[model samples]
Target: MVMATTASTAAPTSLSSVTLEVADIEAARRFYTAFGVDTHIHLRASGTQSTGFRGFTLALTVAGPATVDSFVGAAVDAGATVLKPAAKSLWGYSGVVRAPDGTIWKIATSAKKDTGPATREIGEVVLLLGVEDVKATKQVYTDRGLTVAKSFGGKYTEFAAGQSSPVKLALYKRRALAKDLGVPVDGTGSHRIVLGGTADAFTDQDGFVWEAAASPAPTPS
Candidate 1:
């Protein structure tokens, strides 16, 4: 049942895991694991504050178009909001889902062949942030010791991937991001980036949130 895609596309710079915060850990895990994502759940007191989409994760290498449909369809079947119906996109066969916890996931798959299951069910997680100012947002990470691996004019940028990085970092303009999500460009609510790593919890200049992780946590919602 669980298998990694056989696509020959290069895997990301060694992503380890991606953790999400959910009020109901079990519900989140059930939804994510339904589609074969390696899911783990941890209990923490729910502070008075709420959670929302702070960022997104996009996986490029997948078994093929059918895999994309299966995963995206599964997410929708699990009560996820279909931000974009599975179809052709800038990347390949792609779609977006707003999970139960308000976390938006952008799942993408290439046209490559599907070999089999990966060590982990899904491929690397590319942490994507949507900001009004791309240059300023790029500076936030560059100042934090993350070097830019690639960048484009006022549209997109990706931080240099590390061997042990939990998820790769990327930035896209707000409008461009909204267009990708097939949503309106409001730039009002959360970007769904409540990510955790080996570092402490901190908020970026654009207000995205990240936390610290001691090890490769088999994390869930």
Candidate 2:
């Protein structure tokens, strides 16, 4: 059975916020604030570190490196590996590490900026697929007329379906994805699919439900 914790109906039309796990809330707070991310909300408690933005929320709960290591274990067991490990980068981003689930996230402070962008540009959208074999999945998509945009070893691969806008579909090892989503591995694939407008989620292979949409909801629609 697939369970969705939030009421979000679709994969966000545009990239909203990416969450990260941090070891020190105060340090993480200072980093992002310095980076110029508008910190609209901040909470420090025994079990939670949550922040809100205009369109999204980022949560950083207190956990030890072992917890993160355990998460890595879960991901590996599910057939994925750490793309990057938890470390403090000179660039000012700090977090435990990154996983091969098609998204790169970090826990760190925001960089200092003189001006904020009036609007954000849309970037490539990513999808994580759980397939029987990485080679076979890549072949199938390629055979279906999709082109390989990039490949991260045999564990992660991206496909370009040649959409006019910047969008791409990705395939990843399922176990790693389930770990990233903090869910149990049922050996099925994603449940949500994203289109061009009004995002909606649907159940797909292996009862994995995902969210998709054409674009972000209009302001007054």
Candidate 3:
């Protein structure tokens, strides 16, 4: 396992924070807080919000469109790959992007027609992948069979295969990704297979760790 020694000199700008909706907000909060991120608990008269200093905001909400578009665009501008351009669907306007750690982000606009605060909602599900080479990883997904939905330099790339369910995947450079996500890179490599999903982690010759996940049907809007 390689310890991340390089710190990102670039301070975050534009993206105020990203919120991840979880089945258990408290569990998510505990996991991330233990990962070295500064956390804040905001309790409103109406509800509560947990914000993480790792440049993301976490909460639970029904998903919506305008929120999806705004969130996806901001992530893309901030070096994330915009997989599927935001568009209207039977469900809503959907978009996909890759986070710094090779996690797939599925963003969808709401299907309901309303102008209220709850009209549009945003959420993200992460997919993990394993790869031998970051450069080759990008190529395998972009070269021939797959389609390049979007690319952010060599750091990240997104591909779409026209699946009925949301399919946005990202390739991450192992060492760099570990530093960004504040996780210790395990040299031995690991593979996790869930009933309907699969994830594996391995290092390339350059010792870059990688993870890939196959998610269930996109979360209900």
Candidate 4:
């Protein structure tokens, strides 16, 4: 994976990994693996709380309609429910699917598909989140020291992309999110996603969970 340099001159925290809580770890793993994402599973302890989604979507960008159809087909074969079938849109040929774990995925390709596979083929893995307020949510991350790549429409926004992990971050209005998913806008409950690569465990203003993946190096030990 090509690393995305931080837009910040110095970031207080950098993400190491992403975690999603699924009803069946192995099942979720198989789905993502077939979809070309390798996820490590952690069986929640007996006393640990379970997880649910406020709203989330993992997006993938491919070279042409062929790659888009191929990968989306693979995801469908793996038991994912197709929310939006592959087709041309204002953006390009795009489709949406929801995994058994309730994570929504959108696979899309550009209209002008001359870009090499090296520049294409699932280069973008964006995490589109549902939040109470778009501008407020954007501020939460920016205040934490991240940079905004692009944002508009008051209902949607995204962090600057080209990061170490292709999983770019984005936000949307909660009501808009529910409308997009054809579900109710409910932000109460476990986020189902875990942010890794930090020294402390903290929840975002929106209540998403994050855990430390590694400790910093010892000085002159």
Better-scoring candidate (lDDT), 1 or 3: 1
lDDT, candidate 2, equals 0.37
**Model 1: number of clashes?**
15
Tens-digit lDDT string for candidate 2 (60-143): 321333333343444344334344554434543224332222222223233322133322221222335554356755654454
lDDT tens per residue, model 3, 36-81: 1212121112122222211211221236655666566666654555
lDDT: which candidate is best?
4
Pairing residues by index, what is the TM-score of model 2? 0.36
- Give the C-alpha lDDT of model 3: 0.38
TM-score of each: 0.73, 0.36, 0.34, 0.76
List lDDT for all candidates, in order: 0.60, 0.37, 0.38, 0.64
lDDT of 1 at 216: 53
Candidate 1: where is the Cα deviation over 4 Å?
1-17, 39-60, 112-121, 187-193, 199-201, 216-221
- In model 2, the worst 10-residue window by lDDT is 50-59
Off by over 4 Å in 2: 1-119, 161-163, 187-221
Candidate 4 deviant stretches above 4 angstroms: 1-14, 39-53, 112-120, 161-163, 182-188, 197-199, 215-221
Query: What's the true lDDT of residue 195 in model 2?
Result: 28
Once model 2 is optimally superposed onto the true structure by TM-score, how far is the C-alpha of residue 6 displaced, in angstroms?
37
In each prediction, how many residue pairs overlap at the backbone (N, C-alpha, C within less than 3 A)?
15, 29, 16, 4
Candidate 4 per-residue C-alpha lDDT over 107-176 given as tens digits, one digit per residue, 9 for 90 to 100: 8777645444433256666777877678876765665565787889678887764344436678887678
lDDT of 3 at 15: 14
- Flag the better candidate by lDDT, 2 or 4: 4
